[model samples]
Target: HDVTADDVRLAHREGYVSVEHLKRYTTLGMATDQGKMGNIIGIALMAEALGREIPEVGTTTFRPPYTPVSIGALRGRSVGSHFRPLRRTPLHDWNLVQGGTMTEAGLWQRPWYFAQNGESLAEAYVRETATTRRSVGLCDVTSLGKIAVQGPDATVFLNRVYSNAFAKLPIGKARYGIMLRDDGIVMDDGTTWRLSETDYFMTTTTAHAAPVMAWLEELLQTRWPDLKVHVTSVSEQWAGIAVAGPRSREVLEAVVSDPTIVSNEAFPFMGVIETHLTGEIPCRIARISFSGELAYEIYVASDYGPAAMDLVWGIARPMDGCLYGLEALGAMRIEKGHVTAAELDGRVTIEDAGLGRMASTKKSYIGSTLRQRPELMREDRPRLVGVFPEDRGETFNAGSILCAADNVAGLGEGWITGVTHSPELGHWIGLGFIAGGHGAWYGKTVIAADPVRKGNVAVEIVSPHMIDPDGERLHG
Candidate 1:
């Protein structure tokens, strides 16, 4: 009564050569439900009958409408605002109540801009940027990757993984480090804080968290099994708020129970301290800045994120500050000439990123040998640079190809990687890569052509550091 192994063998022997053919010849998976539950079993039977592996037997490609449905059923009952699945942060509801224009960041619905009454999106974001530069500003930066690394050989393990030296980094201090792939290209860059001799905390770019953790585990498991190192991702366990600007320390000192913990003498720039705020809220504050300002990032338990954000906002409100959003954050980093994943793009070498010097010559690292290859050290390699539109009003989109006016299309000398309207520069600025970089095209006029976006704009090549070339505000 049931289809036996002999049935499958008989079908294959009778010129039903393919699994798909065998299925159709015998109605093996063509029952009422149409093979969803039976297809794998049918495939295995066909493979065994033919004495071939499942992969060798191939799979049936199912065209759309896998289960036949009415046109109305294709369109679900949920529509309009309910169409897409939305993931929220701890401060999601609070951001909504504050009239934030929530948008998708990764999978999370984060506030893109908090528009006041009648304010345009441009006006709102520009105002946010200017306010952050002039005074204190708070941003929910919990989306960044956090991983706790510990074990007896943790320092040695980190030193092997990152380009910079970390074996002797003093406790309570954090240092920015760059990671490189085996091919000598930048993988990810972030700060690592030494908590103790055997403990360290590492932060990575938001998207690279899981991949970076996996890379570390693979290295330990395969390359160096004797090394005693362990890594655990803690991104979901904590929330991060970046409080940045000239008045950041003032706001921190006002709220932190132990003023000395955040004082200049005790916790200078790049210093990290774990302590509590008012209401005995457990917290860790790091004197780190992404806006090129004197800033500190406060970390707290995930459940307490909204309360921590509220506390910072309350203290910063009287200090002539505001709550900034993602737009402002992007603009500030651009002004600082910082290289984010957008600029790295997985293809650029550490040398091409202008961070080659940070790669240690004193010690061998993961990519050290590969990085010194002749091809990677070529002088004509595309390197990071800043582009300022000749007409300040003109904005260029990313993915535009840069070329000398005479060059043919698609044969670009370089390309724009990111673009933003810089409040500090009072113009549209972009970060990009160019062959024979930096001074190779100094003062030369080039055309940025976006065939896809149907845009072409003339731009002047300039030093990436359009804002503080001397690093004044960042260190002050």
Candidate 2:
């Protein structure tokens, strides 16, 4: 309390890992989530500590979302139809015309399938699964969370909050980061793209966009409130169309970009840049593909959605780029070993998501104390792991019991959180948590039983990363 802001800046220049820590030790940006409040003022003091001018120290950027919006405000009127932004396929209105039912797959609300008379959810899901597997069926992915984080402080805020480093990421480049609770558990995973040295855009789990944005603000405005930053949920301002399959890219090439448009090199994997589509509409295009192929996240003004979907489908139709439903995506991700909200939820830790390397040691942050507890540090803490059935007709339901055999045979070891009948793998596969995750248990056998699924089944424990076993697909 006796020390001045200049003293705090001096301590930081000497080597503080994060501005949040600088706030605690020197009280720099502790002005609520408006970190820049103190940051601007703090930097001035920091300059004084170094005998430099305020201009020499610099200032925060003008990012989007000038202030924090309440979770309630963001939710607004679409409590149900609007609880989330609805995903519509080129034929979505047609499906509604045919009395089809819809549900969410990731952030996209895709039609489960067309029912004849009295088909249950299970029946609908099975039919939808078959339709995509055999032939081509359309699914909507517009609901997938897409956000635009702008301003100079964009990269600055991203680097401090994420467990991974992103300060040096080049423009048009994207990086993956896992959000961690102070105890070093996985909270959320998302992709961030550096649009410019000062501007960054990121996407989080559809369910976590609000909270993650809030968390970012809390850091910039509160703990490290001096940092300049802005975050906006443009999830609805723009829409995303994901057309997957072996032919997705070829079909897309059919809808050629207008002249003066940046080519593939300008927006490669994790590439982020602004461009005009069809030679008119201004859009932000990111070379981000989640379909496990050469894909692009096409962003356009809300007004251009109908045209965008039609143009994309027109291209895909000839190449057999079936709009694989959410079901297929789920199957694809599970087989690829990626973890989603259903599997890792907020209750999970960084260890479970296989991201212990993201934590920063240079400075302390929220939950820093709880993260270091011995119990949490233990290698085996019900880490998120993949499971494969051992015998014939073996599959477990969500929340099914998991028992460790031979290796962690002490008691009921863990439980399955996400289960789906894999069309690709044929055998029922699952993602679940198990105690004693380290050592022999890493490759040991665990029995997963679901009373709802005709009893218990045996599954093998494996790493959470199911796709790109070697990171070939992501980089390629």
Candidate 3:
């Protein structure tokens, strides 16, 4: 039966004032189909009853699924075979053959780990991490966001967007840059490689690919219309593989046409090279490391990705190389005290994240003025630091509140954001924030109270760099 006009009047008289409240109270549009037919009628009735025009009364905001449709229609031809709309890397099929434990990251289906028979998920990830630290390991990093910036004003455009200086960066060099929000919080961190005098390749975190592209477009089209800069997203056009560890050069030398291209003397760390593999497969390589170890990220065209992946695997197998996944990737970053979206979450300022020095003073960039607000530079702000369980065997939960050991009754000093067990350090380490930074609590013991998980642990505050404080391993 249709909803009668009286239902609307009764709902109003009962004090269900707001349109949303009235709708829910009367169950006016709560049908399985969300009342595609009855919504307008109900709105009209309410407006009439309220002695106001329809616009004055207003209607519920229309959302998705405009009209009722079957799931079958949405699925269309992409039934079981392609239901997930997954973006697979070139070695996706080969990873399956190697017993990869697949996981979804954004729209891409990435391997979480390559588990061996009789190995649990944790064991597999730990083993992969240990192997990479000891020898060589490769990870498919194709999901990273890529953008091609070409034009005479490309340098100027980048200089305006990033906090660090990039206009003077020479060709064949890569610089790590961090972009901040208009309100001074970090937006994203990535490496921008200077391909030539007028062109550069920018890489962003995978989750920010689309938004960052939109940001650049807005800046160019709305703000700097006359700037000779053209930006295009090329994440799909390029496939990336990060070769990390001490023996990375050895494995890369075998697959690349010129072994000298990757030599330390010719291609120093943070160097970029445009070249081809032995089979004439075109590629671009950047010497960068996320794992605190010597590493190189190799990028090839989409069509040649599969063959390149296979070739690298073939060469790496004989050279004691292993395939690792996201679990190991995260742990390695934690050990190195690096921050991703997890630590740079939109609310914190650059100084709070321990990246204040990266923001330049001599030159202007986005968020430069806003970042200097006196309130943001307070010494008591929650600053990034490493915490370790006192017992070494105990572990605290992520999101656990931190408090002074003697003042457990207080609100909180800060909270743990990330946790990981370091295979190299042989203990559980964490990245967290505290109100009074290094100067205040440099070696003091604090309590990590995890109310949600019903647990607590005594932790020692230390510098975020839990391993290789001098970065000797990374430079190796």
Candidate 4:
């Protein structure tokens, strides 16, 4: 290929003046030699075109292995399954002993479902979901990213990072919060529990755990150095298990040293308590429910995790409770229309995820101004909604394109992000995003067109809160 300064000048004339943009616009640094010969010439040309010194137009960032390296050099030992490390929770072996089928969640091998008496995946999860709703269920939640934010200015730090108000979050309580990227897209959503006046515990999704921690550190170190705050990852320090269901309180009452503290009046929903489990094992319990059931998440030191699981399982098992896993967890969240990684994908805005109300109007936070960009606030943008197969027994997969019943071609209105058999509704259900949201399509039939899979099914658009719209079970 011929190299020329004319190409750089053309890119600059086209408004791709930044070195990064110039390189991309004109392929300045993408030669076989990796720009060693022509990148400088291109920069000088770009700078000349703008009538600026060469230093004024900064150089493009260089990526390493300056010279090309062989594939064998990069793959010294790690390859195939060993390429990435695997993480196991303290209850990993216990789940296997109880017939849990494992699946990957990021680097962690979490139980997908617990099969009993040779039940299929669907049968097992259905049983697990039903049993949990009817009684108690325990799930390993240790993979969630745990960060301990403590300092004199921790409250101020949290209030600015989160889109919602956190300064007024009372001590001994937990509040759901969402953070946004500088570009105004939702970065992550999780719950933060205030342990004391200056101490707070935050949880992030398993896949985002590391990134969220790094993001926080970057903000404190680079953006808000004046703030006196320290954030540390405590994910490995604590092993967490969620005890959920209508009978969740009953199960906790049996395990906690003081039954009174686990009561509805004493503990209350979203309340946090530092208490001891059976045998006086110290633990932190938070009243939170991802399954939309009255539930509590108990956290114990990593070393005490196995013993804590044993104690909780012993009591829950005898009470007809079962151990649920990721599959059931997904089904439950879908039933309640809760958003997860599937919906919080970087492309979505807070409002697109049906969480606009969580964005505080009283105070400005990260992404506050940019989120108001006209393009993001457009009413026609795809927003979260519930999807259901028009035929009771029909099933559709996630990633299926949602189109009007009359038009099943092209990208259509929107797409399904997640799908599952709703044991509660006794049919298949899904959570997806569609233009104009549920209000625009409620009671209307649409085509779930999965062209890649060669299937197209008619589906009804409805509110994301397909079950427990009023959250009766969650507060029961």
TM-score per candidate, in order?
A: 0.85, 0.70, 0.84, 0.85
Candidates ranked by TM-score, best first?
4, 1, 3, 2
lDDT of 1 by residue, 116-217 (tens): 778888888889889988998888888788899999999999999999999889999999999989988899999998888899989998768878999998
The reply for model 2, stretches above 4 Å from the true place, is 1-100, 104-110, 113-139, 258-267, 358-370, 406-411, 442-444
Against the true structure, whose lDDT is highest?
Answer: 4
Backbone clash total, candidate 3: 0
C-alpha-based local distance difference test score of model 4? 0.92
List the RMSD of every prediction in angstroms: 7.4, 17.9, 7.4, 9.9
> Candidate 1, residue 402: CA error in Å?
0.9
lDDT of 3 by residue, 431-458 (tens): 9899977677877889999867857799
For candidate 4, write residues 1-476 as lDDT tens digits. 36677787788778998999988878877876677768988888888899999999999887776697776898776887788898988888888998899999999989999998889999999999999998999999999999999999999999999999998999999999999999999999999999999999999999899999999999999999999999999998999999999888988999999899888888888899998999889999999999999999999999899899999999999899999999999999999999999999999999999999989999989999999999999999999999988898899999999998888888899999999998889999999999999999978889999877859999999999988889887777
Each prediction's whole-model lDDT (CA): 0.85, 0.63, 0.86, 0.92
Best-to-worst order by lDDT is 4, 3, 1, 2
How well does candidate 2 match the true structure, expressed as C-alpha RMSD?
17.9
Where model 3 places Cα greater than 4 Å from the true spot, the runs are 1-85, 409-411
User: What RMSD value applies to candidate 4?
Assistant: 9.9
Cα deviation in Å at residue 107, candidate 1? Answer: 3.1
Q: What is the lDDT of residue 377 in candidate 4?
A: 99
Q: How close is candidate 3 to the true structure, as a TM-score?
A: 0.84
The positional error of residue 405 in candidate 1, measured at the CA in angstroms, is: 2.5
